[model samples]
Target chain A: MDKQYSEDSRQFVPETMSNMRFAVLVLGHGEMGRSMEHLLSGRHALTFWERNLEDGSENIPLEQAAAQKDFVIFALPALPHAELAERIQAHISDHCICLSIAKGMDEQGRTPAAVLGGVLGPAGRFGMIYGPMIAEEVRAGHPGFAELGTTQSDVYERTRELFAGAPLYLRHNTDVIGVSWAVILKNVYVPLLGAAEEAGLGDNARGFLATAALEEMARIIESRGGRRETAYSLAGLGDLVTTATSTGSHHRQVGRDLVHCAPGDTCGTGMNVHSEGIHSLNMVQRFGLLDLESFPLLRLVRDIVNEPRDVAAKFRPFLDASFADAASRNTRD
Target chain B: MDKQYSEDSRQFVPETMSNMRFAVLVLGHGEMGRSMEHLLSGRHALTFWERNLEDGSENIPLEQAAAQKDFVIFALPALPHAELAERIQAHISDHCICLSIAKGMDEQGRTPAAVLGGVLGPAGRFGMIYGPMIAEEVRAGHPGFAELGTTQSDVYERTRELFAGAPLYLRHNTDVIGVSWAVILKNVYVPLLGAAEEAGLGDNARGFLATAALEEMARIIESRGGRRETAYSLAGLGDLVTTATSTGSHHRQVGRDLVHCAPGDTCGTGMNVHSEGIHSLNMVQRFGLLDLESFPLLRLVRDIVNEPRDVAAKFRPFLDASFADAASRNTRD
Candidate 1:
C-alpha cells in the first residue's frame, strides 16, 4: 500500500490500518452519502456514485465501481433502491455486502430489505442499517447509534471493522425483518408529534402520543412476523424520538403544515415534497398491510392526513378511546 | 344538593351531578397541590391542608379535613408521604380512596405505594397516579395522561369519575407496585439526557440514551416485582420523554450543571436543591436495591452524579459496551 496525503497539508504519511480496510462504494451524493464519506474516507478506500451525475466530476461507470467494491452502501432514497440493486447485482463481487440506510417502502410497499434481498437472490449478503443516525450530526463528529440487521455473521464483523473508529455504533440483530419494519414504521409516527405540537396539546399529550405509537408499532411489527422487542430498540423508539423531536425533521414539519391548512387541503407547505413518512403512511394503507381498526393511533394519523380539518379535536377522542381500550385489555389480563 | 355559582359569577345555578360528587381533601399547598385544585375545584367539594403552613388563610385541622372526605390526594413530595399517610389513616373514611402522585421513594427506599399500603392495611383502597402530569401544564388546562394503579375496581371507577370532565386522563392498571417503581425509576434517567445535551452529543446520542435508559428501567422494574410492560407505558417511557426532553426539566439541568462543574464539586447550580432524580439514585444505591453490574446506564448516572469530572467522555464507552453486550447476548440466543 502507498502512503497517503492529508487533504489540508498534502504531506505524505505512512499507510496505517489497525484492521483490514475494505473498498466501500457509497451510492448517492446526498447528505447521507457525504456523511458516510466523512466516517469512512480515512479508514477505507472510498468511491462515490451519483445516480443523476449531478456533479459530473469523479464519474465512474456504475458497473466498474460495483465490480471492484467489497461493500455497496445504498445511501439513496428507497425509490431508487430496487432498480439500482438490480443494475449492480450481476457485476458486484460474490462476497460484497449490501447495506441500506433507507427508511421507507417503495411504491409497491416493499421495504428496502425486501428489494435488496429479492435482487441479491437470498445469499444473505444484504442487510439494513437503521436507527437515530441523523446525517448532519454524523458529519459534525458526534456519535450515532444504529441496529445492523443481517443473517450473516461475516457481514456483521466486516461492518464492525469497516467503521471501527467512527462515532457511529452498531448493535447486531438477526431479525432483518424486524429492524426493517421498525425503522420504516417509526417515520409514520413522526407527523403525529408535529400535529400534537401544532395543536397545543402540551408535553403530556406528546408523551401519551409517543407511548401509544410505540404500542401500535410493537403490535404491527409482531403481526408482520417481526419481534415485538425490536419496536422498542434503536430502530423503532430511538429513531422515532430523534425524528419526532428534532427541529429539522421534515415529517414533523408535515404534521405542523397539516394542522394549519383548511379542510381537504391536500398540499400544505410540507406536503409539496413528499416525505418518507407520508410515503410509508400511504404504502401501509394502500397495501392493507395493517388492520387499521386494531391500531387507533395509526388510524388517527391516517384520518388527520386525509381530512386534516379539526385535527386538534381528533386527538382527545382518540386518547379517550385508547385509555378505555387499554383499561379493558388490562381487565381481561 | 345545593345550587352552585361559577367562581367568576355571583349568579346561582341549579345543582348538577351528572355523576356522584365526592368531598375531597388535597394534602399540600405546593405547585402540584394548586394544579390538582385547578382540575378538581369546580367538580367536587374540595379542601386543602398545607404541611408547612405557607399560607395562613383557610386553615383547617388535619383530622377534621380527613374525617369527612371521600378522597385524599397526596400532592406533596415523597419524603412527607409516610408520616402524613399514618396521620390521616385513622380519620379518613373506611371507603375513601387515597391516591398519591408522588414519584420518589421514601428515605428507607420504600415506594409511596408500599408506605401507603403498610399504613392503610389491606382493604386495597390505596392507589397511585403517575405519568406526564407536569404541574404547570395541568394548571394551564392542557390534558395529562396517567396510569391509575389499584387492585380495587371501585377505586379505579371513582378515580375515573373524579377527573372525567377535567383534562387529566387515566388508564387503569392493577399493578400499584409496577406503576410506583416505574414512575420513580424514570427520574434516574433524566439527568443523563441533560448531560448528553451539555456534551454536544447531538440528537442521535439523545435517542440512544433514552432507549438504553428505558431498557435498563424495564429490567429494574421487573427485577423488583413490577411488570416490565409498565416501564414502557406512560409512567415509565412517557414520563421519561417528557422530563428528559422538556426545556424546563430540573433533572436535565442537573446533568448540564454536572458537565460544567469540576470533579468533587458537590453542588452545581442544578444540584443546589437535590432533585428527585438524585434522591432516587442515592436511595437505590444506598439500599442495594439493584445490582449495578446488570444496569450500565443506571450505574453510569450514579457515577456521574458522584464524580462530576470528565462527564462528557463517559458516554461513548458506555454506549459501545452496551451495544457490544447486546450483540453478544443476541448471539447466545
Candidate 2:
C-alpha cells in the first residue's frame, strides 16, 4: 500500500518502477477508446484509429500502428472484432499483447476472445479486460478494477506495468474463456433489472434478480467450458451490478423503454443503437448456445423482450415459479 | 410453476394445500409486522402485540399471545430480542416456531440467533428470516425473497406453508448461524457503499466495493463458524445489494450523511435513527471478534465512520491499497 498519496490523489506514481512506458494503439476512438486515452496518454505513447474519422484527428493506417505498438487495445464493440483482428494479425509484433474491452458477442455469436484466438491462432498474445471498468468512470479519474485474462504471465506483467500508477487496476486470471463469457453474458441481465425497477418491484426484487442472475451466469459459463467461480467474480457479478444499477446504463434504458412502449413498438427510440443486451439475448437464443428452459430468469427476460407488453405481468409469475422451484430443489437436496 | 394465476393475481391460492391455516402472533406492530399481516392475514388467524398500545388496537398480554399462537414472529430489532425471548419462552407452546427478522447486534454484541439460542436453550424452535424482504416491497404486493434458516425440516415446511402463494418467498437452509451473521454483517457494508456514492465515486467504484465487501463478509462469516458459501447466498450478497442500492435505505443515508457533515458531526440527522450498520461495526470491533488487520475494506469503513472528514480523501487511498494488495497477491499466486 502506498502511504504518501491521499484519497484525492488522482494519480499515484508507482514507486517501484521509474519511467516505464509502452507504445500503445487504441482501436476505435469511441467512448471507451477516449477513456483509455485519458488514462494512458500521460504515461504511454498512444496512437488512435477509427473507421470513420472525426475532424482534426489523425487517421493512422492499421498495419503501421499495429507493427510498432507494444499493446493493441480493441476498444471497439464486438461487431467489428473479427474483421479488425484479422487485419492486424500479420503486422503486430510477436511480443505485443492484444487486449480487448468489448463486452458483447459478434454477429456470429462469438466472444472477442474467440475472435482473437481464432484469427491469431495458437500462440497469439491476446487477452481480455473485463469487470467494473465503466468508461465514463475511468475518464472521470475514479479508479476502475478489472480482471486480465491471459495465458502468459509475461503478458499479465506487462499489462500491469502499463497501467501501474493509473486509476485502472488489473488482477491476472488465466481463465480467459471464463472471464470472456462472464462479461459478455452479463449484459443480458441488465435490462431485466431495469424492467424490475420500472415496474416498481422495489429493492428486494433487484437483490433477488441480481443473485439469481449470477447463479444462472455461473451455470452458463460452466456449460461453455468456463469455470463457475469466474461468474461470481468481478467480471460477472461485479460488472452486472454496475451496469444493472447505474442510472446512465443504456441497457437499463432499453428495459425502462420496454415498459412504456407499445407491444410491437421498437424499443430504444432515438438512441439509434441496438442494445448489446437485446442483441446478445437474440444471438444466444438463435444459436441455441444453452438450454434457456433450465434458467427461469433468463427465459423470463427473453419472453419479455420477445413480446414487450405487460412486462410486470410477465415478471411476477417468473419470480413465484423460480422461488417455488428453488424451494423444491432445496428440499430434494 | 403455477400457470392458472395471472401476474395481477396478488393472492395465488396454493393448489397443493387445501385451506391449511396457522395462528400467527406478530410481536411489534411496526413496519415489518404490518407487512407480515399484509402477506399472511387472509390465510391465517392473526394477532398483533406492540410494546405500547396504539390508538384502537387491543393489547394482548405477551404470555397470552405466546401460549396460543402456532407461530411467533419477533418483528422487533435485536435490542429487545433477548429479553422478549426469555419472557415468552416458558409460556410459548411446544410446537410454536419463533422467527426473527432482526439484522443487528443487541447491547451485548450478540446476534439475535445467539440471544434466542441462549435464552430458549437447544430445544427452542427458533429460526431467522433474512434476505431481500424489504418491508415496503412486501406491503406493495411485490415478490420478496428470503432464506429461512432453521434446524428442523418441519419448521421450514410450516413456514413455507405460511407464506405459500403469497408474494413473500422462502428457501430453507439449516445454517442458522451462517444466515444470521451474513444478514447482520451486511448492514455494515451498506454505509461504505453510501460513502462511495456520496463521494461521487462512479458505478465502477460501487461494483468494486460490493465485491470486496462480499469477499470480506465471507471471510468474517467463516471465522465466526459459518460456511463461506452462505455469505454468497441470498442472505448476504442479495440483501446487501438491496439495502445498499435502495433509495429508501436508512443505512445508505448514513453513508451519504457522513459525506456532508463535519468531522465528528452527528450523522443521519432528521431521520432520528442510528444506522444498524454503525452499531454492528461498533459491536464487532469492540468485541474483537475478528482480526481487523486481515480485512482492509472493513477497516477502511470503520476508520471513515470514526473520522468523517475528507471522506473522499480517505476512500480513494483505501481503494488503491486494496486493489494493489489484490494485484500483488494475484501475482504471487
Candidate 3:
C-alpha cells in the first residue's frame, strides 16, 4: 500500500511507472467514463479517445483509440456494447489488457468480456472493473472501491498495482462470468426495489427483495457459466447496493417516474437511462418460454414498469394468488 | 387432474388405488412448517409433527415422520437440519418422498436435498422447496409460490401436484442442490439489507442492495452445486424480493430490532412462529465458514446484532465503505 493511497489524491501517479505512459482510451464519457479518467488522471500516461461532442466525431473511432493507448476501457451502454467491441477488436493490443466498465450482456446475452473474447481472440487478456463506484463520487474524492475480475490472476494483481495508490478498493474473482452477469442483471432488481419503495413498501420489503434478488442473480450468472458466489462478492451484489441506494441511480429515477405513470407508458424515453431492466425482464420471461424456471416477479416488474398501472394492484395479483394452486404452468417438461 | 380436486365433496376420491389416504405430515410446526399446513389444508390430508403445547406430544415424533406419511416436509432450523433428516431417515418408508421446507444449507454447506440424499440412503427421495411465500401468505389465501427441486422431474411434478388447489404456485426444477442453497442462503441477505436500511439508506441504496444481494446469492448457490440461472428464477430473486420487502418477513424484524435492540427482544420466543431466517443466517455463517460468496454482509449483521460495541466498530468501517468494494472481491488472476 502506498502512503499516498490513504491521502486524498484524485488520481495516483505510480512513481514506479512514471516513465511508462499509457493512453487512457475511454470509450464512453458518462459520469463513469469521467471517473475512469480521474482515477487514471496522474496514475499513468494517458491520451484521449472519446467521441467528443464538440468535435462531432462518430463514436470514438476505434482506429484512433488503438493507436493512442497502452490500455483500453470500454465504458459504453449495453446496446452499443457489442458494436463498440467489434469496432475496437483489431485495435486492442496483445499486451494491453482490455478493461470493460459497461455492465451488460450483448445481443447474444454474452457479457462484455465474452464479446471481447470474440474480438480479441483466444489469447485476449481481459479485465472487468465493476462495483458501485460512480464518477461523481470518484471526482469528489469520497473514497470508493470496485471489483476487478480476470481469468489470469496476474492481471488482477497488475491492475491492483496500477490502482494501488487510489482510494477504490479492488477485489478479485475467477468467475468473470458471474461478475459480468451480476453487473448487468442486477440492474433489473434495482428498479423493482425502487418501484416497491415508490409504492410505499417498508424496510421489510427491502430486506426480502435483497435476498430474493441475489437468488435470481446467481441463477443468471450461473447460466452464463460464472461462479455463483461471485455475485455475492463486491463485484456483483456489493456494488449494486451502493448504486441502487444512491441518489444518482437511473433505476431510482425510473421508479420515481413509475410512481405517477400508468401501465404501458414504457414508450417514453424521457428517463435518464435506457430501462435495461425492460430487456432483462423480457429475458427472464424468455427463459420461462424456454421452459426455464418461472421468475414471476421479474415478469411482473417488466410488465408494470413498461405499462404503467396501479403499481400495487398490478403487483398484488400475483402476490395474492394462491400459494398452492396459484403456481402457474403450461410448459412441457 | 381429478374432477373432485376442485370440489368440497369427499365422495369422489381418486381411485388410483384403494382408499389409502396419505397425509402431508409437517415435521416442524415453525413458520414454514405451519405455512405448509395452510397451503395443504383442504387439499392434502394434513397433520403436523411439532410439540403440541397443550399435551406436549407431537402428532408423530420426528423419528417416525418419514415412514408414516406419503410426503414429509422437514421445516427445521439449520442447526438441526441434518439431525432432522437423520431422524427422518431412521423412520423413512421405502417409497416415501421427503421434502424440506427449510431454505438453508446443512452443516457441510450442502443443500438439504444433497444431505438428505446421503443420510436417507436409497429408501427415500429428497427434495427442496424454496421461495418467498411465507406461512402467513398461505394462511391468508395469498399466492404462496415455491420451487420444488428434485433429481427426477417426476418428483418435482408430483410435489407440485400434492400442493394442488391450495392456492400455492409451484415450480419444479432439476437443481435441488441449487434451489435449497438459494432458498436458505437468501436469509443472509435480509439482515444485511436491514442493517443498511437501519443505517438510513434510501430507495437507490435499497435498489443497489437488492441487485447486489441477488448477485451474491447466485454466486453462492452456484458454488454449492446449484445453477446460476436458478437465481434469476422465482426461487432465487423472487423470494429475496419478497423477504426483503415485507414486515411479514421475520428476518427483517430481527434486523429492524438489531438496529436498536436484540433479535430476542422482538420475537418473544421461537415458540409463537418460527423465524428460520435467524437460524438460517447463523447456519450460513457456520456452514459457509468464510465462504465470502454466501453472506459477506452476514458477518457484519452477526457482529452488529450479536457483538459488543467496540468489536462491532470494525464492522462499521465497512458500513461506510463503498459498497462497490464490499460486494466485489479478490481480483487477482
Using Cα atoms, each model's DockQ against the true complex is 0.44, 0.49, 0.13
Clashing pairs in 1: none
lDDT tens per residue, model 3, B1-333: 233223311211111122234577777777677777656666568778776768867665566555677887777755456766776666766667778776655556655676777787755576877776666644444445566677665566567567644545455677776777677656766766665556443332354455555666667777766787677566776677667656566776655555554434533233113445556665556765446444555555556645423322333355334333532343311
lDDT by residue for model 2 over B1-333, one digit each (tens)? 132222433642222243578898998888878988877877899998887644744477888888988899999889989888888999998999999999999878999999988988888888899999888766656667788888877888888877776777688878888999898778888888998899876788788788888888888888888887788788998999998898888888888888887755665342225777778777788898778898887788788877778787777567667666766777787
Q: Candidate 3: deviation at residue B26, Å?
A: 5.1
Model 1, A102-172: lDDT tens per residue? Answer: 99999899999999988899675977999998886666666678899898877876787787766677888
**What local lDDT does model 3 show for residue A144?**
51
Q: A139-248 in candidate 3: lDDT tens per residue?
A: 65544545677777767766665665555556566677778777776677777777766764433344445555666666666765777776676666666566555677
Model 3, residue B89: displacement in angstroms?
A: 10
Off by over 4 Å in 3: A1-30, A33-100, A104-128, A134-158, A172-248, A252-260, A263-333, B1-34, B41-100, B103-127, B136-142, B149-155, B173-248, B253-306, B310-333
Candidate 2: deviation at residue B131, Å?
A: 1.2
lDDT of each: 0.80, 0.80, 0.60
Docking class of 1: acceptable
How close is chain A of candidate 3 to the true chain A, as a TM-score? 0.82
Better of 1 and 3 by TM-score: 1
TM-scores, all candidates, are 0.92, 0.92, 0.59
In lDDT terms, which candidate is top? 2
Candidate 2 falls in which docking quality class? acceptable
B1-333: candidate 1 lDDT, tens digit per residue: 012112211111111124768899998878889988977877799888885455554467888789988899999888888888888888988889998998988889889999999999988487799999888766666677888889887788778878756767788888778888888878878888888788667788788888988888888888989888888899989998888877777767878888887655665334635778778778888999888998888878877777777776676568657767766776676
Q: Report the C-alpha displacement of residue B21, candidate 1, in angstroms.
A: 0.6
- How far residue B233's Cα lies from its native spot in candidate 1, in Å, is 0.3
